[model samples]
Target: MSERMIRVKDIELCTESFGNPAHPAVLLIMGATASMLWWEEDFCRLLAEKGFFVIRYDNRDTGRSASYEPGRPGYTFEDMADDAIAVLDAYGVKKAHFAGMSMGGMLVQIIALRHPDRVQSISLVSTMYFGPGWEELPPMEAKVEAFFNSMGEMDWYDPQTLLRNAVDKWRILAGSKHPFDEERVTALAERDIGRALNYSSSFNHSYVTGGESYLGRYGEIQTPALVIHGTEDPIIPYVHGEALRDSIPVAELLTLEGIGHELPPAEWPAIIGGIAKYAAL
Candidate 1:
């Protein structure tokens, strides 16, 4: 695997890749406030072994990438979608299959909507489309809310506290069937903290303002699409995935039984296979 910084517009994205570049590409987009490492090195290698050139990158304000003003990100979601396309252009890839988790999934939807001809296939995992009543959606599970709500109380300046909060948050969202992996969670939190340039700007992700709904455009997407979600996902919930599947005319839905928000190792085989099939690899 190799890592490099690719310039997209005015910002630079820290990107890494696995397998041969000559192979069909599969770009993996991580969720909100997440770094590319969330995609997991093993996961990328698995896809590469399945005959794909896998690419994963840190979205702006995360990892080794450039940082924006704290509490205020000047760009919009459309710009982030364009950043994905810019990454493709840097690699000289005309088109590639995309698999995005949570907020990343929302970005892929926008990418497909804006640049339909540049997408081969899309996978929306643990995310929902924006609609008129999206803001009025029911509150998250109590434990889930409590877990995230605790973020405001933590000291962001203290690395140890941040890591503890990160580990605890993942533990709460962990699937009951798979249980929690303490060692793995610890490693992930440490890696994320180490890679982050501006840890406090984590909240900037939620502050991005002004974006239109994709609810009316879902059916207009011509690319083959897949919606994968854990049956027990606490963050986005399974119903959101259902809504996405129902909206996209040619979309396929894959529900991982008893799985949660995080992509555990058990669900990878099905998720990777689903993306490969959707991309017709």
Candidate 2:
């Protein structure tokens, strides 16, 4: 069963943890503008059944963990990283294997850099070392704006409409070429609305080089790591996959051809397998 709490400045958080406590832990870090529900129940359970103590939760600004404070400066990724640390602390865990997707992937980089001892291994999926650029590849501003627009037109204030909007966004991000379970996404968005941020700070951090200067800090990470990305990812070019692999001394890269941004249901077996294999060592 999933549990919930208010943490780090009274922000609500929803948590789902299972499997043998004696087994190694796996902490899942989600992507930008995402909630814990997006983590998917089947995925989490699979990890648990695979002999892992799996932990997944909603970030402060997403899902049941949200609270709006306009005067509060949009939370920085650094602080967000700290919040992630707080989660581990709350659970009384000294360390665990971490697997992050997109923005969540960036958070692991920070943890591996700033709190190396707290991480057993790293798995980065569809994430960039830094922010996406207009020159390298145009930001998905239009699609994101369209998401906002569709919400407004559907009167997002209504819970059901907002859920539909959230589901649609997931479908689109999945490229809609693959089968997506709308019911799951809808429930995720439903829980997500309560944790929605009207003006939450996102992806804004002081970067001397890029958001994920983990490249420079790579040598500090003494743990094994893995980098996974889709070959057809338009948001972050496959070059990042190569870069992350090249930078981390003990990292391996897995490039999936034709896969889009989101992890599809069809690939869960391989996804869980890859992680279980790495965490074993």
On lDDT, the leading prediction is: 1
lDDT of 1 by residue, 168-245 (tens): 888888778886888988998899998889977756888876447644478788888899988888877787777778
Give per-residue CA lDDT, model 2, range 189-280, as digits (tens).
66567555541322122221233354346666788888888776656667777677777889888877676678887777777888888888
- TM-score each candidate: 0.95, 0.81
User: CA RMSD for every model?
Assistant: 1.6, 4.1
Mark the regions of model 2 whose C-alpha exceeds 4 Å error after superposition: 9-12, 70-74, 131-156, 175-177, 194-216
RMSD of 2: 4.1
Q: What's the TM for model 2?
A: 0.81
Q: CA shift at 232, candidate 2, in angstroms?
A: 2.4
Output the number of the TM-score-best candidate: 1
| lDDT of all predictions | 0.85, 0.71
